[model samples]
Target: MKSAHSSWETPDPGYWTKQGYIIVRTDERGSGQSPGLLDTMSRGTSEAFFDVVEWCSEQPWSTGKVGLLGISYFAGTQWRVAARKPKGLAAIIPWEGMSDYYRDRVRHGGILSDRFIDFWWKNGVQPNQYGMPGRAARKWGRDTIEGDLDKATLEQNRRNQTLDTVTHKFRDEDYYKTRDYSPEDITTPLLSVANWGGILLHLRGNVLGWMRASSEHKFLHFIVGRHDLPFYYAHCARLQRSFFDCFLKGNDEDGWKSGKQPRVKLCLREGDAGVDDPERELLFPHREEIDWPIPDTTYTKYYLTAEQQLSTTSQSNVTSFAYDAMEGKPLCFTHKTSARLEITGHIVAHLTVSASRSKADASPPSDIDLFVTLRKLDQSGNEVYFTGTMGDPVPITKGWLRMSLRKTNATNPGHHKYLPYRDYFSTDVEKIAENEHYEVDVEIWPTNVVLESGQSLVFEVAGHDTQGVGKFSHEHPEDRKPEDFAGINSIHIGGNHSFITLPVIARG
Candidate 1:
């Protein structure tokens, strides 16, 4: 019953209420009207969610069938509860919810994301903690109900929430796994909605849930827009209604029957503005498919060459570049295609990298942090940046990896010839030998992009993300500092060590 939607947001429940559906919204423990401390995604919250769903079904006004739906936090709880398989829970629409807390939130690609989490904690969740007077009370009157928790309880809740994310920076640890749930554990019918711009938190989870979930009725739709915008978008709302009606209300007219609904629907970003102007001036050209890693996908390898070029043919020459972890220049490779191309799936790059301590510094970094970004350039060689999750102009897709955690998971089913999965578990850590080359594979998230003829594809390898530029100033708090990265880094190309595999969708 806990609601992450603001009290002032009428459209969420308003849409359901108008459809003759009852909406039950409650505050979870330690927030708003709840009394206990906020434990974030702890097991306690999952149990409370299960209890509330069952309680709601028992009510006289209920039809004894319950379905879960929401965006972000509201959507996240559905994953946890569905895994528990609450009795009355019939269907779930986990719109933009992250399934793995470690991979999706605290540590992304084994790098701590302290900036976004800190910002989210201070600006997003703190204000809604139990002790603060409710927004309703402030807007309504002094007689209105204040939050249930006292001042002491609220402070303790804040401390606990902070420790949950900041304390543990490793993945698959007891702290993170205890609060995490596998998609395979969920048996309920699911409709996952993903946003391409939700790189900071939502996108990965949605895709992972769809790909890993064991549900036979699972459906995934990739939309073009900001994280929260798509949840209320008219098209998305209608689709959600159809899915719920088919599952929760036993209505077959909703167009969600097996063999009827496409397993994946991609909302391709078209036009110059990209997904920035979702309200207007942008078109969401959609493509439907029965599965992802799309069947018949043509995997093409683009080898990294010596002359700062990407070519289809492999090269034996080696290339190296020196970068000052914090401020060094990045190595870039460009490919100008003669024919138009459309890329619509996962991309993986393999590179041979090595690092050495800067002579000026007594101590050097034991491991290297690499940030890989794929960008596009127009015919005139101008960078083509798109509006991404942070509402700023960013490259198409970005990948990150800490060299020490680059061990591949041999047992992961998702790993194959073209696609390799990096295991972020603590056991996978293998320290890098100073100045010894190590082959590492970095996986960029799935994306749909159309490259016109004469346009060029650009790839950049850097020690840190570019910042201070116009519309690209955002930085993550967990970015490795200059002192920690006082070293010279090199990227080796040639032989079997350097190449990128791209899923090139065949065009008629």
Candidate 2:
């Protein structure tokens, strides 16, 4: 479903016809010329998707096989349609579409991306900003639910609601019922292209979908740049054609399926870092041995020293940093410069901390999100940056923790290290040991950066928002400061609990 202003435009139905393929660009239920309430994909929206695909298959110009294209919302409907398994459906090229709607859309690292989605709906999808040209009138459409079911205006719409009203139910029934997809029931072939630096709503879902989907033939590709950058121009279109040609038209799998099976892929060295240069070519794609969590990685822990040091030793009950709210100092952790090192994986911080308040207002048994950034500085003290197709600097890997969502005590010691404390929500935050040290695991986001030996690796522990990385932005123009951001809490760092774990890749 192309938005009114989205550059989701195609090269005309003639292009597909020339290739002996038929293309049908119908206004999905409520949006364009179609008559229906503008309910944003409630239960009715999923049904509408099924109807659209089925309708296209029944057309005389069609060959009874339907495949989906486009990005963002274009890839979104695939979740619902694929889950239903329409017989006429062939394969899907879901460009950056992840299966878990909740994780990709609303929340990450247990923190609600309070600004991004609502902002996108208000500006991008609903209003079609960014100067992209389109003809669909940008207006607030109707709701499919709560309206006359048999009338022409509401018939096409399946639900009468928008995401703005249903933000409260991440773990509840409202959004879950409509947004959730049954990965087990979807067996169709899929080609999911993800963007490494897609801060808004990319990367994570692509990784999860490629791993979780029941589809036997699934290919995962990663590009670099802004979330929607790949959709514009001809690059994304050419790749989409290759995908549909192989799956929809029964063409030979030449470009679509070829070469070194890359499970985890990255678009190579891209973008200008801390320097001004005319942005280079649009994109560069790279492949990896494993899909998620990176492959062939040697996971090593970098211990924190009491005297503000980073070491590869287990100096038990040693490292600690003072993290007071008003006078907290930013601690620096560094390793000896070696050869050039490229660290590409997730970095986790396993810390035991104590707070000044026995019952702190800010550090409640709630899942509190803290920001962790991995940076590199050259010998001359210059910060290095990376850019790719999307024309944006990318972060390696990121993680989250809910103060109350933490789970530390597992009977199995082997599994204790890999416990579910990463971001899985737990209800009992109040029961954790009070006025004492408790384990706090801060997960850094995934990243792909190259650092030289003479240079240093820096990890920063911050409580408020840092604009350089993920989508959680306090200064986002559309975002009004929410209640959570206003709260303040102080972290106590001591010998028993506070250190950053680094996965150091030895320099060659």
Candidate 3:
């Protein structure tokens, strides 16, 4: 079921309606005007969506063919329903959708995104619930029938969803797996649109969905803008029309049928504010390739050295930095390149760390919570942040991990080199013994950037996000603002354990 408000309207329905195609938007069960418990992303919701699709195919005005297209919640539902492979479903465009509920939304890097979820529930879901009194209800009118459900039932549904997220701290739990759909189950001809700045919700799914989906006719496109802006943009809309026309209308003349569409179209940011242009035109330079994780990518390793420097050569000397887990600054390492470098694809950092009880503290910390950020710096050493999907400047990419959940899943294969999948299921939690060291691999979200000559790559290893400033501060309540962490954390560097692996693309 769609969780967002205004599910009835498509971004630009005229593009489809003008082509003589019927567009249907239904309020999902328990949402909008639909009568049912508002259990978000439940198996029941998926089955209900399937029933709607199949029913639509049998309608009098129907051609017995159906397709799905939408952004965010709409896009997310498409992934879940398509996995069921509903009969009469022809194609789907999951534009900027989050595939995995745990990885993409709730628990990022095993940390609860309490702020985002709380913001969503209060500002997004509650106000738009069937009979809620707010702007959405004033404009769209209340779903009086569904509103008939006792207020207690409505409050319980909201509470259940939030409680489920907080209680199930690990990903391997049944709560998360039941809501997660396998990309292998999605066989429909699919066009997945991803946004580069959608680190918080959209990017991971778009990229991972394309990689895992068993569909033979799948295509991926990357756009740079606010999460919802691309859906209505003429450039993206044209692409969507061509894809639907080729699959649904059997239009052989459509560019997609002629093999003119690139398997991956990545947009590169050109200026400070990539989303500044009001029209949101595709103005940046881009690359077209047959697939993602570009074939000729050179995985480069930049080691964290004793002198707080990032270098290509591994050093034998071990380095350590201790910080108050709650208020200490991050351990940063900067490296300046001699020549221009273009980096694309997934990035992973191999770190060896140990935690201990601080002399000034009363009790020992059971686990170490680490937050890693990859950033760019100008020649003058100023931090470079890019405009994100929300119109705010954000660092290159960020990753987090509770050291206790750092065990890697050797059985689950990685999608790319240096990108090993970690298992949050196995609970092998242990406190650090004196002089004990643990090897942890942190997966920094995938990024595409062109580092000009003399530009420096800066890596920050901290207990919390350094960019949590002003309007952009969306932090995990516990991880970001811990009441008190009575321990000093250290990052060990030397030998083979401390290096950041970058997916460096070779230039001609």
Candidate 4:
């Protein structure tokens, strides 16, 4: 199989060699070893993977069938290539990689990703194209360098700005076209593996790909802990090897020999404070349930009361939180569990919001952020947090819609109602307006949880960061404390329209 490292590490040949699998690790186009313009978002990269597969099949040492493997960008390319239905491509194991560039990796809850492509390209993508800088040069750099630095060294970096100029063209047609994977075309068998903490990366896109693809033999596995750390474990590695062995080596029944349904494993760690959890902790594999928005769910609405409370009872003319950039966080609502219950499915948010800035001042329309968080409170009143596919601890179950991008799709049923899929949205160029109120829906990614009696299922609606609370939270020097955390958010509510929607779970 063909695998290449992101600007970081290349595939470790020693590991693949021991398994008797021939590994082809090359840099993506415009990256190391390869020559061409760098398409950071996997356009040319997908074609490269397809080319490698065909090459491998034709080689003397090759089997007719080829399987692709890798994590993050590598994992993502699997879907992009599979969508192309490359000849000789057999199956794919996209570990912790997002399927949709628009939904999972680049944007979250309609907010521009905090991890900007420009920043990543400048800091991560370019350096890998060149050899690692010497120790002296490393001191001035800002990325994951291991050494110390001085002021003069930092000054030198300001002049080396190739990445800065390239990534600013994010919305260019060339960039978007390079990353598109229109699912209707993908027919290959797929096994998507991800870390629960890798939530923002692979979690939703994995589920979306598994459910929507043209392929019938698709599966998903989510083993919790952190991103990329699972690959080092014995059990995890065995699972991956078995997957490739069955698909690539034509060992058809091998993966199912033990009578286990294809599973989604979630690592369960102790929720105690001050206890450091090991990476790739444990695996809890679940049998496939019905497709998401689980046919079994009741599309229930929890009214956002004028009093700022979430209750099952319906109310009208609610008081909304104005879209104040400086507003405090939204309040949370919890329900005491009367029985043991497990909620496994997608959650939706529907609210009416208005912007404080004028159309001239706003970035075109407005990109408003609504934060949706799901938490489980123990009987002792302690809160438990889960890690997202990004390998960060996020109480955030899912995030959606920056308001202005809330376009309705007349074709897709998933996009028709209060449940809005996080598909990409473009600007409505001619109709832009300022300080207008609009109703929109946000779909939080799917999650699986078991709540016991006396414990409550809690949902917090706020505009703030959920990262700093846990080890798995995505962080950087830029994120602020309380002002950005869940405690305060500014929202405006005045019309009879403001409210939040929930997929009410009911026992059969």
Poorest 10 consecutive residues by lDDT, candidate 3: 1-10
Best by TM-score: 3
lDDT of 4 by residue, 315-399 (tens): 6454555423434444565666677655556666666655444224334333345666767778887776665433344553656
Cα lDDT of model 2 overall?
Answer: 0.55
TM-score of each: 0.91, 0.76, 0.92, 0.77
lDDT of 2 by residue, 1-508 (tens): 2333333433235455555766666555555455555566456767888888888888888888888775666776776788898768888877766556655665554455665555656564533211212323333333322222334423343342333434443344455556566666778878887765654465666665666678866777766555555555465566667767877877746644454345455654322233212244243335455555554566766666654555666555543454532224444556545777666655678766544432246443212345556666678766565442245554444454545545543543212332232323333334333345667776554455666657767766555444354444423322212232223333444443565655444533
Candidate 1 deviant stretches above 4 angstroms:
1-11, 133-152, 279-282, 417-419, 467-483
Clashing pairs in 1: none
lDDT values for all models: 0.73, 0.55, 0.74, 0.57
Query: CA shift at 148, candidate 1, in angstroms?
Result: 7.3
- Give residue 413's lDDT in candidate 4 (0 to 100): 46
| lDDT by residue (tens digit), candidate 3, 274-311 | 33344443556888998887888888899998888889
Give lDDT: candidate 1, residue 453: 82
